[model samples]
Target: METIIREDTPKTPYVKLDGEKGVVEIKGRSIPENSVEFYKPLIDWIDEYGDDPKDNTIINIQLEYFNTSSSKCILDIFKKLELLFKKGFKVQVNWYYEEDDEDMFEAGEDYQSIINLPFKMIEMEE
Candidate 1:
């Protein structure tokens, strides 16, 4: 499987999905005008990656901010990871949030609670 890379825009995050290494990274903002359209390909890629996933999958999420629509799309991404985790794949989500950003930290906690995958809340220097 080829690696999926997408540049970051003012309304979207920089995405890097490496199928060979099983590493997924999404950094920057995520408030796209059409969240569903923006995230569809990403979700689909995860589905395809699931078919032949690496032994260990690491997901790093570092979003400065996201709108309501993006929130749902983010959850969809997590759900995909959960499926892999349930299948006994070693999966980890590193949720990075600015130390001073309470909302972002709470959002990570919320996702951790919802998804069955192991998540690590990382406090980034502001």
Candidate 2:
């Protein structure tokens, strides 16, 4: 499986999917004009990874902000991860938020509540 690495842009987030380690990360802001275009490959990658997953699969989400469309896409990502968990794969989602960012923290909590995977909410100093 190939890794997916995309640098952050003004209207998008930074994505780093390490296939070898089974760790995927999405950071920065995500308010892209076309959410589908931005997240299609990511969803596909997750699907493929889930098929032949590693012992441990961790998804690290550290977004400052995201639009409604991006929110749906994020949910889709979590759903895919849940599938991996159902297949007996070790899956975890590390949701990172700034210390004072209540909205981000709550968003992470919402996702945790919906997904069956082990979701850890992490508070970062920054």
Name the best candidate (by TM-score).
1
The C-alpha local distance difference test score for the whole of candidate 2 amounts to 0.92
Q: lDDT value for candidate 1? A: 0.94
Give lDDT tens digits, candidate 2, residues 7-118. Answer: 9999899999898999999999999889999999999999898878899999999999999899999999999989888988889889999999999999998888888989
Model 1, 25-119: lDDT tens per residue? 99999998899999999999999999999999999999999999999999999999899999999999999999899999999988978889898
Clashing pairs in 2: none
Q: Against the true structure, what is each candidate's TM-score?
A: 0.98, 0.97
Which portions of model 2 miss their true places by more than 4 Å? Answer: none
Name every residue pair that clashes in candidate 1.
none
